[model samples]
Target chain A: MIRAALFATAALALPTHAAAQETPNMPAATSPSPGVWIPRMQARAYLLENDQTLLEQDLRIEHGLARDLSMWAELPLYEGFLDAPRPSDGEFGLGALEAGIELRVLQHDLDAIDTVRGAVFAGAALPTATDGFGRQSLDPFVGAAITAIFGRHGVNAAARYTFVTGDTDLPLFIGDDGEDVIGADLGYAFRLAPAAYGEERVAAWYLTLELNGAFTAEGDREVLFAPGLLVEAPTYAVELGVQLPIAQEGSDRPEIDLGIFAGLRLLY
Target chain B: MRHPILIGACLCAAHLLAPSCTSTASTPTAVTMSYSAEPLAAGEHELEVHGMSCPKCVSNVDLQLKRLPGVDAAVVDMKRGVVTITLSGNARPSARDLATAVSDAGFTLRAIDRGAQGGTP
Candidate 1:
């Protein structure tokens, strides 16, 4: 399923849309504080087998509707090779449009420097891609995320499942079988700069590590290990990371050899 | 695939149906009405804010407080969860106003203590 891989590559950009004070490659239970609006952009390149490469640029926006409610929308543009075997030069077009809402279910402020939060989110992707680059059907998904922060160390985890409603005709290992998809991710962040907080408004630096896994209904599975660095200020953030395949099994498409991403975020 | 979706849906439904479970325990009650009618004197005021754990969180509080008219400066001590605000001369922001700003920033104002006029706490 070259189409599946294309969509999956776009989906990988979703985690970079995290709210304020979150790692770059994982879903965090935290949202923008109430009345805040965040705009984000990310560029990603995936190096696949057969000398093929997929490039994606994603633009997203997030808004805090209330103390416990937040929403986000994302649109991606893709340009690169789709057929691993054929290895044509490439095509460029828009990908699916995705939107989701998150509701914080549990939040506990243990103290001034420690807190824990949990949230559940649901959303759907509209088949808005240019011809031959998308699933061409509405796909619904659901997920849960958690965040725990203890001083300079933070942990975030999330899991999601998407219902694939499109049709795939390519043979197994080269194309998707139209089966649903499941994904799970875990991330850790350590503040590397500004050993302590003070009165001045100083930019903070963070080192992050994430483990991302995806599985298809037909047993195709892939896991990636990503490490990143982030610099965050009061109203903006910059981040960059690299992803390497740690394990892959029962895949039905071209394997990803490497992925690199860079992103920026601004809050208003 | 279907199983995971079903479980996630059920969990979402369970959480949505239970408002109490989703509410934060430290959500501040309506205490603004208890604030004195008199505006805080022109001076530095120390406020103990809750639910701030990161630099961005601190910045949120800082920005909201500085948005209030008459606030000369807002200094934060993150480790102590304290924000010291200095009011300019002729500035007459009420306690309720300060509390509302903090609330709007998604934090709780646990307590406020006024310092000497025109001086740091």
Candidate 2:
């Protein structure tokens, strides 16, 4: 009886290799992974009403703090034709500093070929204008974003609400009332090159179209359409885009007709 | 400074064709593609994972697996989507516990293979 008991104990102690079981498809995970920082710089040129123009640049950095949490910050510089017909003598100064944190709430791997990701974020824009560039008030905002990926094609939709807090009586183009902004980005990635299994790197090219719309509590509204291209690798990506205003309301305010943007992001 | 449109156009055209024009040396190398395993411990396990598409995903699994209580080391192979985990001496976690860790890292564990002595290569 003691020998039989010892045999049973040995049998149970043997290694157990679990067989492969079919798992239900889960949601898609983010590409950059967690614990990485991506820093990007964007420059824009805007064609405003009355043949005036605005040139703006932004340096943005984002970090994935955890699997479902991330943070970001941005510094903006602005140059605009404050005086008519003197494009060379326009006001050039710093605009605003913005920061935010995001928490991913849902991610679903629909199948082998599809994924969905969603997140919500809260942000603040601090008044850091040098002279004639930005609003002189603190603005806090909340936003949500969702991305659906189908193999190489993807779509991103985001909406943000800003609560304006200071100097609401400024010019319409600079400061209005609290506003709502909505945007959508659609992209398709082409594997221009493939990396071997043991190779250290890979590359992909993408074409994207973005539609941005904004509405202010004071009845101001506008829409912009942008088309862009992107080339991304493991640690770096470059993007260029052109924005054209497709719709607008409130004629007395300065309006942007066309704009261009180019940016690069570096990961570490 | 003078003609923003011309500069922008030139920059865009150059960037669009740069990837195809340049070789791999110019592209950023993949990060965290390989893992160096530590010396084997007593309670080691190997998992066959699925749905890892890039090196970044490998890193994600690595981070999560290392967070487990008894996990001493975790190595992930992006190409094979395999994960090998080592637990400290006298520390043993069930196969289901490991499967849950992989799942929490947004991956699927297809199979769990344990060694005779609870250590897997």
C-alpha local distance difference test of each model: 0.73, 0.54
A160-246, model 2: which lDDT tens digit per residue? 666666544334352344343333333333323333223243544566666776766555677777777766554455566788888
> What fraction of the correct interface contacts does each predicted structure contain?
0.48, 0.03
Q: List candidate 1 segments past 4 Å from native.
A: A1-21, A84-87, A170-176, B1-12, B15-17, B29-39, B88-97, B114-121
Worst 10 residues of 2 chain B by lDDT: B25-34
DockQ of 2: 0.05
Residue B59 in candidate 2 has what lDDT?
A: 49
Question: For residues A136-250, what per-residue lDDT tens digits would candidate 1 score against the true structure?
Answer: 6677788889988888888889998777777434322211456677889999989887887776777788898999988876777889999999888766677889999998776
Best by lDDT: 1
Top DockQ hit: 1
The i-RMS of every model, in angstroms, reads: 2.8, 14.8
Candidate 1 similarity to native, TM-score: 0.82
